[model samples]
Target: MDLALYHPAAGYYTRNRTVIGPRGDYFTSPSATPLFGRLLARQLMDFREEMGYPAGFAVVELGGHRGQLRQDVLLEAPDLAYQVVEVGDPLPAGLVGCFLSNEFWDALPVHRVRVAEGRWQEIYVREEGERFADEMGPLSDPRLEAYLDGLPVAWMEGYETTLNLQAQEWMVQLGQCLERGFVLSIDYGFEREEYFSPHRPKGTLRCYHRHTLHDDYYAHPGEQDLTAHVDFSALIEAGRQAGLEPTLFTDQGRYLVGIGQELFAEIAERTAGQFSRERQAIHQLIHPSLMGSAFKVLIQKKTS
Candidate 1:
């Protein structure tokens, strides 16, 4: 999984077509609409003001692809130190402001597991004549079983899913990196109960190829993008362990509406016959049926 996504030479993200638009494998919330970055900039500015506009106030963005969100935010709040962090780059030292990322966690490699005959087992992938196949066996690591320790006993019977300990570990590392500030993560996922529910028999892993979603995680090698839905509960627990306190958690639609309701209204009133693309973009971002409800906003804070 790691080699397929992050392998130095041929990984999906490290290739020539590294983007979130039509040419890329998938579309993210921010790339869906410029308004996503515009409205989000407003909130980032608030984070700055809440911290009394400290000097060297950096807005460090992880997985900041070509500075899309950073460009949008800095357009409005140019005073803030904007840094877009790519993989293998050094993290911002002693960051004292917003540490933001969107759709970053789901891309990390995960351990696939399933309940086999009343006991848990890990799913393995092997290459066979240029094609990949799964080989089920004993749990790859002890922590794989421990990952399910908190699930409801009944749901564990036939459940198959991913266990992403990397996300939790990242929260701890991010918490330690930020001197004193907010951590804002935006992604598509659910709380613990829904994530581990019996109703979701297929788990939450998916692959994207040219805007089409599929379940062929092992297909196309490094050509397609693979992702799994994030488990916010584990992230929260990890943050708490790292002394990062939760400030807000809500659907993206609600959070954006609350932050930009008046602005959207004014833009609507001002542009009567323009048939603006910007308007459509913002609509796609906040409409409940689309990307809005599919994404969530999590904000945590660390002080002193």
Candidate 2:
């Protein structure tokens, strides 16, 4: 999965910046509106002030492609130092400020697992001839095996799920990087209760191609986009283990609305002249039936 998405060359993210937006496989929140970043900037400024207004403040953005969020955030608060953290690039070393990402955690590779024959097992991917195939085998990775030892998921037969082992590791790294700051993640997912619910027997692994969604991860391999819903509950626990404090966990709709309704109206008028397209996009970002309820935001802060 890492080879398909971050192989340094010919990978999905490294080569396909154009594979986003309305014509692409998916449209992230930042790609939809600058309002998202502006709202973030407002909250960030408050966070910085709330932390006693440090002199050397910085905002670091993770998985920022072509610096869209950076651009939007900078446009609002240009005087604030902004940096984008991409693959093979070092995050602001020991920086004191905000670490943010939009739809970032879901893109990372995950280990697929299942329960069969009343025993836990791992779904290993192997190449057969010119294509890849899945073969069930005993859980080899001890980390994943240990992670699920006491999770909320019921031990039902044939229940499938994914574990993003790297997410927690990265959180640890981020915790060490920021002496004092906020860690913000925005993506589509649910807490442990809903994420591991019984209804989603097949798990959240999915593929996207030309705006169509598919469940087959082996299709087109490096040609299509693969994603899994983030387990926010796991993320919160991991952050706490790394010594970070959880501040807020909520959906994107409440996030935008929590900022203020008047600011949203001003952004709609200032950012878009036609008003029709931007209005629809804003609705999609905040309306529950659209991206609102589907996407959630997590905030973790480190102080002291």
Candidate 3:
């Protein structure tokens, strides 16, 4: 299962030409508007100033879909060194600028597990007449066993869950690569408590196809998109173990407002046009009810 989704040769992301936005499967914050990138640039510039504006600091963006955000950052700050780290590859070592990822962790392949009869079991997928079906297997991975140990018994019982050990592995690698500066992660998720809360019985796993939500992830195989909600607590803990310090944790709206609200307000006030569609699009990007609140921003600083 892991090889199918993350293999360097024929993975969904690597082989497929289009996988982001409404036309492909779903839309991300960057797909919403340039405002997201612009606001992110504000945060990056702040880090640059903090680092004394190094002559060649790199703003490495992981999972840079179509490079729209990278283009936006370049347009806003041409002097800054920008690098896009493609998926399925290790992060560069000895970097001195901010690292960013939007909707990246969710796509990582997670091991599926379930607890039954006071014991945890791995869930495997088998080919069933040209379709995939779930099968029970032993929990051979120690990390997965440890992950289940932290969850409540009720939440684990008979409920499907994803042990996102891959995300943790990625963080360890990221911490090793980042010599200094921030690791900024923007995605839709919750802390460990809320993530495994009783309110969420089936766990945070879903599929997207042409903007329509579906639970039948096994239906499409590599044709549709599958993602699991990130465990922000795990990400932070892993970063700490890897020598990164947690700096800021907040919802996406607050992060944007702190960095880009002023710019957006100024643009709104100066516009003489009457309710232009472009203005509306920009508003939707930051509006409290839309992508603004649905997303979250987590920033961690690498200790020198």
Estimate TM-scores for all models.
0.95, 0.94, 0.93
- Backbone clashes, each candidate: 0, 0, 0
lDDT of 2 by residue, 1-304 (tens): 8887887777888875577888778778888888788888888888888888898988888899888888888788788888888888986667788899998899999999998887778999899999899999988789877877875554789899998988888888888888888998999999987887889889999999888999989887677799999999888888888778889999899987897477867857777666476577678889999988899989999984
lDDT of prediction 3: 0.81
lDDT, each prediction: 0.84, 0.85, 0.81
Q: Roughly what TM-score does model 1 have, to 2 decimal places?
A: 0.95
Ranking of all predicted structures according to lDDT, beginning with the best and ending with the worst: 2, 1, 3
Taking the tens digit of each residue's C-alpha lDDT, what string does model 1 give over 1-304?
8888889888888875764787776777667666778788889888988999888788889888788888877777777688888878887667899889998888888888887777777889887787888888988777767778766643466678888988988889888888999999999999988888888867998888888899988888788888999999989999998889999999998998899988789888988789988788777887889878878999999996
Best by TM-score: 1
Deviation of model 3 at 296, angstroms: 0.8
1-304: candidate 3 lDDT, tens digit per residue: 4555556676667676577775677888778677677777888888999989876688999989779999888878887798888865567889999889999898888888777766788888888897889889899698887777857754456877777998998898889888988899999888888887767767778888778898887866666677899999999999998888998898887887788768877877787567665577666665679766767889999858
Colliding pairs, model 2 = none
lDDT of 2 at 288: 97
Q: Which ten contiguous residues of candidate 1 have the minimum total lDDT?
A: 149-158
